[model samples]
Target: MAPFLTRLSGRAGFRLAAVSVTAMLALSSCGGSTSRSAPVLPDGADPHAPEVTEISALTFRAPIAAGIIQTSRGGADEEFGLNVTPQWIESSATAVSQIVAGDVQAAQSSYFGVIDAARQGIDVIIVSESYASNPGAASLESMPDSGITELKDLIGKKVAVVSLNSSHAVKIKDSLLDQGLDPAQVEFVELPYGQVPAALQQGTVDASSAQGATLAQVKDTLDTVTIFDYGDGKYNGMAESGWIMKKTFIEQNPNTVAAFQCALLKGTEQVKDEAVYAEILKTDLGFDDQAVASDIAPEFGATIRSEPLQLNADILKKIGSIDEDFDVASITLPTPDNCG
Candidate 1:
């Protein structure tokens, strides 16, 4: 695969590449095993059959990561004749760079980031849906002392987000338009998830957007008031993120893609059990607070529906994040019959 130009500014690409390499080395040193037993195949299956494919994937600690984690931990990939190793990534935007550079074969990617990459003429395809937004899944909030109790209060203030034109940012902007407030008047500061709570406490940003573990962190650590929930109104049930592979990779490895989708589909179903989901949060994701784990509501699925995808594309264009029209269907790979 040819390396595509990264949109990351300055030496961010190099930094992310270094991180990816380091993660690979670290995972390899441990024999690249999660220590989970592979599922028992049906009668007459060869126990010593070789794995058909091996893939490196990019993931971070989030609701979406749960599915990937389960795929590895529950031995779904092994059952499907695949060896999948997930590398931890710091920035979602850099996933494209890693995939194009051949550092990773797949990534749990943001819906908005995928759309943005396609608009830049990058060839990427959504292999499966990772997570969708449910009520209270994501929100914009402010510290108690910030006096920002409503959406209108954010008009001329700074808001912190993980990405500038991310789905989080777009939802907040769309909400502002609903309130008759100019979203442009609100400055968006991009900060790492770990730094967002500190930034809000220090008054660096008047409000901040958060989801998944980060949302739990802010609520547990601070007495923040919600300005609005992103998963409300028209944004409810929107496509939040998905698993993506380069279009060329999909064309070259159709069976591998199908195997991945099949494995991930089982993983998605595994996480639906409350006990299993909570255990993953505490063990895999390092969530110390039991309450936080129980409080989080994740909507995991493997099917890439067209309606939610199209809604996100329309929002991106309405918010001026993309100039040209995009058909979400064009960027999606039909689920192979074997995936079921």
Candidate 2:
């Protein structure tokens, strides 16, 4: 048995023990260890000020969202302010689940999660935008003689995804339908992200979904075929990730939320500048192999756009992931501007 805790609670005053995160706990442990001695905090950081001074958010370790919070300590040239302590969660799906369970006050999630929260009547509100350009960029790789070359060939084939109803599966179906192919023809199975490499080697799956960091890794190691790149013209304007929070929390902690958002946006602007990305990626994200696994561009912006979210809801409705059409504007809060 894997030695792990199914439920995790935040420290005092930020107690959020929500759900059983079986995979996140197990997989996160395998992530590369940090080489530095001291925590890589913002310059002149101070996290233990007071309830009024600190904001707590749950995100995956080394995610762009968390980096933004750490990079910009409230504002430029500000020695110390907006003391934020970022708690690491399992995945976007688990983060959304925790938001619904009320264990996580804030987390990074995609449109699939937004739609699910809408259908479940969860009072989750999206605060900031993380991505919007690339939809579900993936590649279906098989043996040279496997004879699986196109979408039509995927019929009766087993494709691996992180989860059954995950955004990857949903977007892959949308991509397939766009190609005038039947999505019901292909089969999908749930598998761990790490296990995909071995499964593909053993022919357990005809192809596996690849995105961002994982996609780069796949291209570097395997002799694979490129089936589809969702970031292209056909898949532009897809829903990206965003920071979500409970409505009540925004009502109660508006200042803290605004402060956090403004700081993150400043950091996002920094990320947009290519001149500083390499240093920041190595320092903030702790990526040892930055050359092989840099982040995919997603039209990262601070302002939340309604079009992508609406398009996502439409896609989810078509796939029966959601029952009714959702109003993206209703759940999205205006961009926070306390630091500016």
TM-scores for every predicted model: 0.83, 0.75
lDDT of each: 0.72, 0.58
Q: Kindly list the per-residue Cα lDDT of model 2 for residues 226-255, writing each as its tens digit.
A: 665555564576656778876667666665
Q: In candidate 2, list every pair of residues with a backbone clash.
A: none
Where is the poorest 10-residue window by lDDT in model 1?
32-41
Q: Listing every candidate in turn, what is its Cα RMSD in Å to the true structure after a full C-alpha superposition?
A: 9.9, 10.6
Poorest stretch of ten by lDDT in candidate 2: 32-41
Model 1: colliding residue pairs: none
Query: Residue 325 lDDT in model 1?
Result: 68
Model 1 Cα lDDT, one tens digit per residue, 1-340: 1111122432364367446544544444333112222111233223224234887778765665788888877888888887777766656576766775566789877788777666555566788888888788778879998889998888789988777656788888877887777899989877766677888888888998877677877887897898988877887788888888876676666667778878888878888887877777777666777545536666888776889988888887777777656777777775545443
TM-score top scorer: 1
Overlapping backbone residue pairs in candidate 2 total 0
Runs of candidate 2 exceeding 4 Å displacement: 1-52, 61-80, 135-145, 284-286, 289-296, 337-339
